[model samples]
Target: MESLTIRRPDDWHLHLRDGDMLRAVAPESRDMGRAIVMPNLVPPVVTHDDARAYRERIVAAGFARPLMTLYLTEGTNPDDVVSAHAAGTITAVKLYPAGATTNSASGVRSIEAVRAVLAAMEAAGVPLCLHGEVTDREIDIFDREARFLDDVLTPLRAAHPELKLTLEHVTTSEAVDWVRAHPGVGATITVQHLLANRNDMLAGGLRPHFYCLPILKRGRHQEALRAAATSGESAFFLGTDSAPHPTHAKEATCCAAGCFTAPIALACYAHVFEEEDALDRLESFASLNGPAHYGLPPNADTVTLTRGAALDLPPRIDTHGQSVTLFDPGHPLHWHIH
Candidate 1:
């Protein structure tokens, strides 16, 4: 098909850092009708007031209608969490296993320590977005997400059955199966995970931009993620964990963990769906499943994508006195959103 149109999609997970970087990248996600803006800022958005202020700044940066969230920490107050959700200041609370990703030093060190907050969120009908990976040094990095499912998420699900949970950026077949087996649970699949695997990051040499938390997995996992994303299942949706770092940071000794794909994510997803021969399901994965999981409605408007000549966009965007590199999906993308 040369052209396709669907409801404007929401990014189920996104990261817009504070200040200059936020300004530089926020506009990149403008087409998303709404986005569940991540709260992993330095010091983190830990309270309702913090989320409110951050949301204001994000709007000021140009991407409006961001559904804000709080960064879950060990000392988080349950009342603060519950009240924030009830007051509509925050949509959900993010749980990051300590040291799991960038700016996550203050993330939860122990799930037990945040039980009160979790219980309060569950009781109040607030959702929980999880960075599903275990930080135990003994567990191989590749095994973390799978281990988290078995050792952390399973029990947590059992303990708080009503707590709405979204497993953010899932990268494994096991994760796909787990979310499928459990109804009402949702998972967000990132563009990088769908387009590239660990081999793309490590095969020839280190390609830092492809490196992300719950780091890219083997090809089998990549296949699994693509299948799940293109399956039109309600449990899976789009979350471009489109993290950005200055070009210098990404090319340095310890590269940053993310892909700066916010500028090109939708077109990339179209390419993935087309490759899977499931363009018919693009609207469901990109625009429908997310809202259903979050108890919202689909966007009324739409964006049309046309398959055409290879996209000739720049490989990087200048921002913050430096530049952020956009993800290069290896193959030339023949799609553009109009």
Candidate 2:
């Protein structure tokens, strides 16, 4: 097909760091219908007021609709969560499991510690977004996600059967199956996870650009992610997890983990679905499933992708005196949103 048109897509998970970094990255996502902004900043957005302030800044940057989230820290107030939901200030609350990812040092250390808050969210019909990876030092880095399924996610579902959850940036076959099996549970797959596996990070030498938390899994896992994303399943949808980090932060001795993918996210997703011969299902995965799962209406507008020239995008974006790298999908994309 030379062209495709679909409802404007929404990113169920995205990261726009505060201040200058926010200005540099937020505009790249402006074309999206809406985005669920992650709250893993240095201090993190732990209250309704913080989310409101962040939303204002995103709007100031010209992004149309920014759906904010509160960071679920051990100290998160259950009453505050209920009030936030009631006030319509947050779309969801993110649980990071402490050191699961970038700026997640204040994430919840134990589910028990946050049960009251979880219960509050469930009562208020607020969804919980999870960075589904275990932080147990004893667990192998590769096994953390799978272990998280058995040790944490599964139990949490049983405890709060009605609590809506989206396993953010899920990267394992195990997570895919679990989400598929559980009702009221959904998962968001990142563009990087769908396109690259572990080898892309360490095979021919370290490729720091491909490094990300819940780090890329094996090829079999990537295959599973592709199948789930293109299967036209409502439980799975697009979430770029387009986290941006300055070039210096990513190349350091103890490099940070994230792939700044906001710019080419949709194009990358198009390449994946086209390869699977599932172009027909791309809209459902990108634009429909997420809204259905979140109980929001699908966007009224549409975006057209014209397939004529190879997709050309900047390799890096410069702002705030630092450069943020863009994700290279490793294959030429002919689809360009018009």
Candidate 3:
């Protein structure tokens, strides 16, 4: 098949940094029906008022239906979280372990401290998106995610059995199996994870563009992600985790962790689905499953990916004088989304 059409997709996780960078990258996601906007901005969106205002700014930046989230903090008020979700000011609450990723210094340090908040969210039906990794200095970088499963998430899951959870940008074979074993948990797989493995980042020299938190795992993990995403599974869906960092920061001694996948997200996902011989099941991963997990109806609109000829997309997007690099899959992408 040369062309395929399906319901417009939604991004289960996305990061559009505030201000000029937000304006520069927001339009890149216009083809998506909605995006669960990360709230890790400076000062972070911790309250209903904060999420509402951030949503307004995102709308002004051209992302019309940004589903805003609150950056969960140890000081987070349970009442504030329930109210925000009930009022429709926020879609979910993001749990970023302290120092887990970029701008996550204020993340929850003790999950026990947030137990009341989690209970409130569970009582109300608010989804909690997790950056599932432990920050202990001893755990090897590659083993953090798997360790998080046994050490942190398992007990948390057992305690909050009724809570809605979406494991954001999951990158391990263990994580894939864990999500499958759990009945209602959802997982978001990114373009970088599907298209490249840890080898792509560390093989010859570090390809900083592929460096991201819950850093890309081994090739076997990539194969697991590919199989899970293309298997028409209900628990896995697309969330680009499309984080952008200025070129200077990315090329620095301590480069920031994220891939600016927003600009070419759909095409890259199409490329993966095509390679897996699962183009027919693309709609289930990209469009159907996420909404079902979030308890929403599928979008009314549609997008078509016409497969032919390599796309000549821009290498970077200019924000002020700095440029944010776009992720290159290191291969010719034949699918162009329209």
Candidate 4:
């Protein structure tokens, strides 16, 4: 093939922080096309006004069309849910278990709170994107995701059969099965989790940049993620979760949990699909599946990617008076956009 061309893809989950960082990084994602902007900002976007202002800022920074999400908080107004969605200000609401990940201290503290918002969202046909991990301190770090599924998500789904859910950055085989079994649910697999396992973070030494919430699992889980992502199933899609943190933050004692993968996300996903010998299905995983799941129109724009090329991803990006690390900083990618 001369070049692999597909509809311009939408990033189902992304974190483009405000101000200079957003300015510095927005273009990399805008160059791709629309993205579902996450709502875990410092104060957290919990209302229609917040989502609207945030969307304006993203547009002001030159993002083509950034979809919005509400950060589900305890005592969140169900009326706000209806207003946000009805106003076209938000595409979905995100539920981050309290303290589950970055800037999530304000996340819903219990399923009761989420149930209220989920009920409103279900009635309005809005999806609930979950950061699937339990915050209980007693749970093993690696077991949090599975525990959340068993203790929380499973029961929540049974109780609210009408709610549409998306399991974000799913890391375990059990998660894959959970999404597969539930017709009302879907999953977004990140490139980092699909390509690397837990050992990769400690392969030679501590690799903080590769660390993320719902942390990477064992190799068998990685294999399951690969199958789920490349199977061309509608229930699975691409969500880069390209969270960028200042380099100083990542190299510190307690590194931030994120991977700045936007610059190389397409190339990395191509590498994975090619290795699976499923390049023919790449468009669906990266482009088509997301819109289908979101009930939005697939992007009409197109991007061309050529194979057999080694592209260098910068070791770190100097932006907004801070340095940010690229996900696979020192690696050479096989695919390059032309």
lDDT by residue (6-32, candidate 3, tens digit) is 999999999999998988899989879
Clashing pairs in 1: none
Candidate 2 off by > 4 Å = none
lDDT of 3: 0.93
- Backbone clashes for every candidate come to 0, 0, 0, 0
- Model 1: per-residue Cα lDDT over 83-186, one tens digit each: 88889898889999999999999998888999988998888999999999999999999999999999999999999999999999999999999999999999
For model 3, the stretches where C-alpha displacement exceeds 4 angstroms are: none
lDDT values for all models: 0.93, 0.91, 0.93, 0.88
Worst 10 residues of 3 by lDDT: 313-322
The CA lDDT at 155 in model 2 is 94
lDDT of 4 at 255: 92
lDDT score for candidate 2 against the true structure:
0.91
| lDDT (C-alpha) at residue 241 in model 1 | 92
lDDT of 2 by residue, 1-338 (tens): 87899999999999999888988888998558999999998789999898899899989976879998999988999998888888889999999988888998998888999999998889889999999999999999999999999999999999999999999999999999999899779899999999999998899899888999989999999999999999998999999999999988888898889999888889889989999999999999999999999999999999998787787777899876769988786778788887
TM-score of each: 0.99, 0.98, 0.99, 0.97
Give the per-residue lDDT of model 4 (tens digit) for 181-200. 99858899998998899888
